[model samples]
Target: MRKIAFIAFGIALWIFLTPTLEIEVLLTALIASYVAARLVGNVKLRPMKILNFTVLLAYNFLVAVWQSLKIVLGLFDYESKYFEEPAGRDFLEKFEKIVLITLTPFTIVVDEKENVLIIHELKRRKGTE
Candidate 1:
């Protein structure tokens, strides 16, 4: 069951990343997903969580691009801050959290220590403080 979920997640990710429907690409996605699922051992996979993560990642990517453009225009400034880990009790979960948090240009995971993440966050320069 978990393996099937992982395979489905992999296929969804592949399509999301490539946005292509070529037969060759799909075959490759299937093979790669199968191989990956086999290699992950016995870890559980949650389809709903994976889907939610994907949606959030896409949204964050767009926002990050916009923020990056603003930074280039000198309309924002950045500062370092610390944040607690919001989720994930294991290595993969922690890694996923790091990826999601760092995916946006407005925020980056600078470091991690004892379940705390050091983040660099961008702020609008003219905003009230």
Candidate 2:
């Protein structure tokens, strides 16, 4: 059943994503989001809800790529003495902040179907709290 698949997937993810483990959080996020979009594709939402989810996913994907590029460029230039310089550190820190923000929408998009049940109180636990 779907529940079994979801549970197995979640356990597998957690095992691989152990706190100190070498898992790629971004990859896990993308997989979860794709699962969500499929689940919602079965829902009977208004046109706007479908559009909202699509736009959020698209933007989140774009931002993730952009942040990754910046992160890579940052690491490449990290040897510059500028690391000790306030401006350089500040730029790196700000870039990190942006990456964190980029993760938020992606996380929310992971539960693409949950948005349709926000008004319910069924105590169903979704991806994020």
Candidate 3:
């Protein structure tokens, strides 16, 4: 069931990413999705959780972009910070978190050591600073 869900999700994602909807494209999507699902192994798919995560990611992306613009316009300061990764997460989950962190313009996972992620962040400058 999990594999089936992953395949379906992959196909949907491929279709959403591709501009064309030809037969060849669909066949490729099916094949690629199947291969990807097989390679990814078991992954539970929770639709509501996924939806919430996607929404949060989009919101963070927009906020990051705004913060980046502010930094570039000299209205903000930048700093490096460390984020502690949650314990007991699998490799795929960790990779997903890393990708999510790196996707934002104002924050990047620059390095990882042990269970910590080294992130660079942009911040609003304090008036006293």
lDDT tens digits by residue: candidate 3, 1-129: 888878787787678657799999999999999998888786667788666656666677677778768768977555555555552267756766876777776667877787777777655446535
Clashing pairs in 1: none
Q: Can you give the TM-score per candidate against the true fold?
A: 0.70, 0.29, 0.64
What is the per-residue lDDT of model 2 for residues 1-129, given as tens digits with 9 covering 90 to 100?
444444444445444334554446545645675575466344333446434544554566667667568656863222111111121133334333333333532221111121221111112134423
Question: Judged by lDDT against the true structure, how good is candidate 1?
Answer: 0.78
Candidate 1 or 3, higher TM-score? 1
Could you tell me how far off, in angstroms, the CA of residue 66 lies in candidate 1 after the best superposition?
2.0
Quote model 2's TM-score: 0.29
Candidate 1 TM-score, true structure as reference: 0.70
Clashes of each: 0, 0, 0
Between 1 and 2, whose lDDT is larger? 1
Per-residue lDDT of model 1, residues 10-107, tens digit only? 88778877857898888998999999889986986666877788898898888888977876897656555555655468877887888888987677
Q: Which stretches of candidate 2 lie over 4 Å from their true place?
A: 1-42, 75-129
* Candidate 1: clashing residue pairs, number: 0
